[model samples]
Target: MQYPEHLAHFASLFKKRDIAHFMSAPWLVSSFREPVWRYNFGFKNDQNLDWRVHLCDGSLLTDPQHVKLLNSLQCWLIASTENAAGPGFTNSWAAQSASFRRTLTVIDHILQSAEALELVEHGLSALTYDVMCDIIEQIGTSSYVAVSTYDWNNRLTDYCKSLLQTTSPESIDKCLEEYPTLADITPLQLEENELEIPLELISRVRAALYINKMYHSNPNGGLNVNSIRVSALLYKDTLAGKKRLKPLHSILGFIWRRDRFIREFDGVPVTNGNPDRMTRRDLVLYRTAFTFLQKISALDFKLPSKEDLREIATFKVTGTAMGRFKNVPTPIIFKAIKDGIELHFEHGPQLLKSYLNIAKYSLKHMVNITGIPDETTISLLEPSIAELGVQYLGISTRSSGRDPGTELKESKEIYFSKLRGNAGLLELIGVYYGAIQLLVGATMAKRGSELRDLDPTNCLSEDKSWLIARIAKSSRGQKGRRARNARPIDPLAAEMVQTLIDFQKDLIEIGFIDQHLPLFSSPGIIGTSSLTSCDVYLYYKNIDLFCDYFEVERDSLGRRYYIRQHQLRRFFALVFLHCGYGASAGILQWMFGHTDPAHIWNYITEELPGKELRNTLSQALSERIATGGATHYTDVIDLIESKFGTRNVSVMDAEKLAEYFDFLMETDQMTMEPVFLESDTGLRVDILVVVRKQDEMG
Candidate 1:
């Protein structure tokens, strides 16, 4: 075979390596006489030619053939490296397979042609430092070192300088024109600013400069900013720009339209002298403002200092200035009375009297639970105006009223009725409220509630006894039906259901209800009550309850009764079919349920008699035959002696003998022949009589 041009070139280069050439020249000449060595010349040992080894060692040559080939190739490689030849630089072991080396070498020669090099240089420059690094790494260390020697002498300074100064001003101008908008420029500048610029505007400008530089250098494609770290920093700095460069118009917009209803009334008191007469409207607004402030305090922002707010006249006063609104907002003040009523109802009539006294005493003294002025409280109550001679607390009510006092008095009546309607209502409310309070308290206390006790069902009233009774009854009924239908009882399925029920109860107790439980309550054919007869049987065909029972029994002797359930069902079907208890159609449906008759026939024919019974029958038959027992005495003695064993002496023996005789007679004649008597003088001899005497002696 003719060697490719590049391969021939490689061979020449290898021959130039001082040590390799000196060692391989004699081997290459000798290889011509050895077919193995000749064949190895084109064989690739390291197909990928990964450039990791500093020297190709003889140890890598698995056979003498590889050794001879590598030796010749190594000499050629060294020569090419020394000469800086095209074949040396362009040849890749990956492309030069033993089967295709000639083609690959031709390709390499073509690629290194003067015409090809000139074409490549028209629009592209020499490789960069990074690209050179990649090449050096790809070539083995020995080749890399050889190439490096040449590179050090030639140097790549001119290539580096050319690339650095390659950008065109026209390209930069074109990029600037394309991205002239502030949105684009500002965002780009912001990204660059994150790396080095501290001033937001300057950083954005720097990013813009970098982008413009890349755009000018690569005019055909946009900037390729692929670094994740750089991208994250860019995003972060852009967000900072948002905070710093917020438009003046936006600030003005906020100033002009921000809601100030709460601020306007902050320091002004609705309740002056009469704390009892504070209105509901003032109370509602006061509570709403307090809620808003509480929410604000929970946020991440640094709140403005009170002194700062005071310095800025534009800033509004808040709830802090009014102190606590206990007496001033009479509705909040009246919460004590409402709470007393709630407590009284919760604890029943006995505790009611005590709470009422507490309410009366507080009312008589005009004591404040929260400390805002009475005038402010009255103002808060004005909106829910009514004429019931009681203060309106701004809570919605069905009663119509125009005066504050009437609305308040009516609200008090409404609140009392709501408290009295359900005895367990307060407890229910307490359960929910206490759970929330417990969770919050736990957060504050840093001690969590037990998961088991957090269930909603645990909070159900004792009055729900009726519901429990109903569930228990339903469960019992279901179990009873399952027991009856699964006659003799499939303990395994029963146990499975029981376990599932226990788990479900546990979930329910923990306030988690699984929707799938009801579906699993009755599973397979038994669960699908609509199925009947053979249909049910076929549905449960794959379940292997009988086999499963047998396995279970085999594993544990005491669990033998587990097989009874399936066995009894089979026995019932067999007996019913044998007894002609129903019409063929009805019996078929009953025995096999709605199954195809062919399937039923197949099952019946394929099924073996129960193992225990089959064994018992086999043992009995063997013993009878061994004893020469016979039941029928009309046997031909000669036939019996010639065919089956010598006739049994006893009737049991004769019966066992006749059983074997009958079996042989029924067998295929070609496979087995039955015994026949062939006597010159035919005597009326009974096989059973002859076998009886022999059985007795034995």
Candidate 2:
């Protein structure tokens, strides 16, 4: 803060620079404009952060004070660059790289964030700029590097571009005249015959040469340099740091590494391989998770640990969905009037009855019509089944569900031949299978392969509490693989499994399938085969088509939220971790099929959004405090609010909100929980803001 000659130095520079251009443009002094610079065209910057720091698009400009300072600086801006892009700052200022604008952007961000208005009241001076640097490094080191490094290579690029512009190609090629200092840099483009020169590329060199020439003649002060405004500029990095994040496009290369080449495609013929589609499906697994995290981290939000990602991957069943049904054709759906069948997930027996009735209808038409069919069996699936399904669901075209620019292109093939499974039967069955799998997977939070291996005879325990799911992953290539009896399951999951058991038992009773087949068996696609057990790959392939027809969820882009089998497992682990479910680490280890305990331990202890959600809750509370609103927990809320002093935490001291939220969580070991309990009306979900541990009896 102590600068002996800082005041004297700034006063000297203020007198030297011409200030006439400050008024050359009238808009700079007029009303304010947002995005005072134009660069990033991304998510709506609802905060309206516009000050033409013009780092990438523009800099952060906030409040009335910045407007006047911007007016004074317009003289320097106009002298060095071009016209303003909207109300923001101009591009190509002082012949700097587009990236260099980010330097000013970061500084403005810090000033506005810290509300250090006094530092900028006279524009950034030498002393104020030094104070800003100390504040910046306190935030993060890598952040400062990302912002300042924009202009780091300017000196080198200037030297190379200038040296190469004057030299002939032969001299450099023969090594007769070489520049060893430029070996690390990329080669420059220089057209000897062209009169055009890139001003931004060589301006630094030209300025230095001009200053050297003037100094040799013993010019005024022997300094001959006047670019002092830049020297006083401190690199604040939050804005510039945001611009340096991992771009969304590089996801293509992130998933497609050389080591990831499909093993099956290596020795086998690549004849039908589309290269794009064929390889993309094979590229999913842990790598997809890595890319997902990388994308999350690039944004300002904290990167999710295992628990947060699990929430994204997990599906929660709503008890109310039982009454809802998307109509598939045929009066069988209306048979509720006669057969006492109702559309509900819990009424799995009624759903099976309807499915069988539809199956019987197909058999009657096929057998009575003669010549085309010889048997009246459920195995002989008719096209009428699909005709019914298609009435309510459109066939999938096998294409993208995400933005073409943001997502990888899909590769899918449709068979032209109308085989037995081709007659819409497979599509309908696949739809049902996908929905079943989605619910079952989320409920069990286990691998699809393991779920498929469930014992139809006794997968559900006597009490219907534990689902005897086989440990396929942990049991691989080991002796006497066994199903875990301790795997606790939801009542809904037990119902779903029992539903599958009843449906397949009828198939086995009529000789449609062998009783020994896995619980996931379905009517075979092959003409001669009666049944085929479902695998992870088969279900994965059928899922997309099923999601197309089913009333599955979609993303913000209106694309289907592609829930994968693996995502389900993560959901189970996360629920147990955050909600403090009965499952222990030992139980999770056996369920997750991990080779080591550390993997399961890490997941169990992974940072929950509870900590992050604390901030969000604080923000919501702060907003309430700022608005002085009424709420249900009046006494408790008043008590909490009274802790803060008169200064508004939301506006006057925004940083204090973190402390207040921390206080709420620390008091009485309060935790946010989603619990359902029996009320006089029915079971109701509890969504309390501040839940006391002892008050939770459910």
Candidate 3:
């Protein structure tokens, strides 16, 4: 890399040892508590010399061209380092939006366009402190702008301090003058002004702003300037020549006017009438994972080996053998089990020699309960799952199946610990294993209160008959034994359990389980810890990889439709609700481990049961009103009175009313007809018409 005379001297001050020391130390010198005289090679020229040549990549340049490349090489390295190491470099929306165009311009300079160098140089220089803050007033203003931008409309602002508490309903008129984006309505002030703003009003405001229906809505409609500006950083790459270099202006126009693709509320971009939950990068990752999964499924892969099984299964040597007490060493009991299994072997290798068929019964059971592939369900398990009680048999909640003592927030450790496991998960697995053993005519009789207490004999059986296992509880306050009952498994449930077992075994055989190992592991962590909540997200990444691998086709509108995990959970909840399942909301709330049913509401569809019922009743009433039909005489009387408020329609008898109407119709003293009209909601209404018959004739 080349450097100017003064800059070269500056660079020479540091020896190789000094550079090494600097790398190890946070600060420059031992005495210095701050980053004093820290080297920054990307300084803008004080003389304001043309820095166009400085933006170019310098690695390919000859020695003769080094002088010409000095500024460009230094600038490139500095920008690259800053981008890689700077705070908020990857996640900051503002930084990404601001630098993306300049980054592209530099790329263009390196590849084809020389003119872009000037633009890139100018952008980079503008970002420098000297250019951004030339005067003291400019410095102060820039500082204020930075602070204001970061804090303005921050979500963390005090509830009372925000628009809700500070601005009264009476002050709304005055507030509108400043923030005219609010809907034009006279708000009723709350007596408890100190209370947090009503979320309902926020919703209404969001809805109004989303449609750009606010009094002083921006001409650009719902699209925000920041998103458009950020989009420009990408859009500029499409431009091949200088004529098409109006990146900022063109992007803003396309987003706000020409394309009209993005929508925004409160300066934030939204999609599908909701705030976009995922970023573009996340969407890309998911798409890629989905493609990968699809491709693997289509490939018809072979079964996994014993080594492959080890990769997917979250097993540790800490637990005792299947039949032994918790503290017993597993090897001491394994000998008998291995011998028994080996004696029963047929076409396969000896039980101990191969991974195949070994633990097939137990694995089958686990799969039946999980109902999904290992990779898919790995995230649902917590890191502390192993520490749970043996009696629970499966993943338990952080509180070990007990509710927290208080309403106070659970720490991340405790929250993730026992988030609760469905007994059905472990029980179903056990049931499947038991069923398989029963089919083999193995000894299955066990009497116990809980399913876990029943232990099936491993020894082979001579009799091929169904086993009757009884489970009865002892009465707590009475001496008499409780009546024993045989619990029955429904045919459908049994079939699904069997099917899941088969599918899981197939997954194991095909080596898909082998690929699930790293996914199940917590990245950068060692030991037998289960995947944390964050690690579990690797499942989604796996999906993204699958989609990418298969090059999945986009939708009819050329858009990729990726399913998120949360979306799947919501769909499951909604399905339960739509199927008229009893206590679905409560069930979902329990399943989701939500303290309040309202949290589960997010999973519910917008067309709620109450809302739908109301709509249906409203439609029925509307139809009756439109047809001028009355279920009762009072309904007719009420309708008549509504039309003719002064008339005593209620006093007239049904026969008298009929006779009067007939006389009126015959004598033309009154007229009756139907009047049709349309309402804003698009409903067509028909009204019964009665007027002075003589007046109409005249």
Best by TM-score: 2
What TM-score goes with each of the models? 0.13, 0.31, 0.19
C-alpha local distance difference test of each model: 0.26, 0.36, 0.27
Candidate 1 residues lying further than 4 Å off, grouped into runs, are: 1-512, 517-560, 564-585, 594-596, 602-698
Please tell me which model should have the higher lDDT, number 2 or number 3: 2
Q: Could you tell me which 10 consecutive residues in candidate 2 have the lowest summed lDDT?
A: 255-264
Give one clash count per candidate, in the order shown. Answer: 72, 16, 37
What is the alpha-carbon RMSD of candidate 1 to the true structure? Answer: 39.9
Please give the ranking of all candidate structures by TM-score, highest first, separated by commas: 2, 3, 1
Kindly report the root-mean-square deviation of model 2 from the true structure over all alpha carbons: 26.1
State which candidate has the highest lDDT: 2
Error of 1 at 446 (Å): 54
Query: Model 3 compared with the native: what TM-score?
Result: 0.19
* Minimal lDDT window, size 10, model 1: 247-256
lDDT of 1 by residue, 275-353 (tens): 1211222222222221221112222223223333223322222211111111111122123223333432343232212
lDDT of 2 by residue, 122-166 (tens): 343321323433433322222223222333223223433555566
